[model samples]
Target: MRTNSPETKKTARELRNDPVLSKEYTKNKIQFQNYYFKLGYQWSKPDLNSIVCRFAVLIQVIRIKREELTESFIEYDTRFLGGNFQIPDSKELLLLIFLNAPLYQVFTTLRKCSKRKEKYYKDRVGQRFEIQIGYE
Candidate 1:
């Protein structure tokens, strides 16, 4: 896990202020704070339910090395409320392959390079990728 630096603080602030968040704080505040504490965050007074804090915690959880994620655990698609919709694990495998594939890398690189005004693509991309993947 990465250390909590200025970048982390900035990210936390951004998450706290994100307008699209549901505005609901987590019920398990202490446990949430403790989780981040274990991951090296030093929050003076953390809001567990805050979107940013929750997002940070989620990032640490899912960013575990790819090898650590087990394929044996069955995942269900509960889209149609109460409907028994099960998706094949292959869907997840395909997504993982695409994300790690060279073609996706090339597409992302080209997209970043084409943005003439933005010189901080690496930082932006890192944060964007984290948020996008975390949400998905």
Candidate 2:
């Protein structure tokens, strides 16, 4: 698990020091805070390892004008796998394909809500299983 490594600290410090990036971060943080707070929820800093480590499910939070929102999982890499966790490449690929399939999307959408408009944001809120790809 890569948590608070020297490189991560350095990048975080750089982001904090950059005026433009800092401003954008603060703005987004505030928006997230406000939205969560309305639901009687408080935001906490995500675990560093969880951000950099582990395979995760990704869901679309925002809807496009004329597109369907689908659910997907991140691809796992052996190089990034550490400790006891072992996920095969083929398994990961299959999982991704299944999760992103139209059938799975329809199933999840149906299970979540009956309203067509509300389906988009059904599983989109709160903490999601999302992979943190690359450095910010």
Candidate 3:
């Protein structure tokens, strides 16, 4: 799924945000994939990664491991280092571990983005997902 790992060491924002921080790479630290770090932080979101990593192992899934979360499996099984994912899905739910969203914000980013019509939702504390179809 990720072929770009070997060619480029860091993501666009990492290079753009600060040229100086890249020097840390020279220290030979464990290398994580570009996609799975914290927003605005060149660091890995371990809690987030742990959720995916653990679940994957529990379900016996994934190419990367929980400890390293490396970019890829190197020749002779060396492994690159860290590998979190930057994709939208990774940021979501335990249903937020998968959705990266609160129940309300899944439809819209704003918590209060949608307001139910008073006529339809006046006193319905609990409602089903079904939408009513008007009579022809």
Best by lDDT: 2
Which structure is stronger by lDDT: 1 or 2?
2
Model 3 misplacement above 4 A: 1-105, 108-116, 131-136
- lDDT of the candidates, in the order given: 0.28, 0.30, 0.25
**Which lDDT value does model 3 have at 119?**
26
Residues 1-136 of candidate 2 have per-residue lDDT tens digits of 3567998888889998997776443221111101111112123644443322222223433323211322221112112222122333221111111132222331011112224534433444332332223342
Q: Using TM-score as the measure, which candidate wins?
A: 2
The number of clashing residue pairs in model 1 is 2
Per-residue lDDT of model 1, residues 23-118, tens digit only: 343221111112223222236545434322222211111212323344442221112222323433332221110121222321111111122313
Candidate 1 clashing pairs, residues 3+ apart or interchain: 25-49, 26-49
Rank list by lDDT = 2, 1, 3
lDDT of 3 at 112: 12
Give all TM-scores, in the order shown: 0.18, 0.20, 0.13
Model 3 TM-score, 2 decimals: 0.13
Q: Is candidate 2 or candidate 3 better by lDDT?
A: 2
> Relative to the unseen true structure, what is the C-alpha lDDT of residue 114 in candidate 1, on a scale of 0 to 100?
24
Per-residue error at 126 for model 3, in Å? 1.8
What ranges in model 1 sit over 4 Å off?
22-24, 27-136
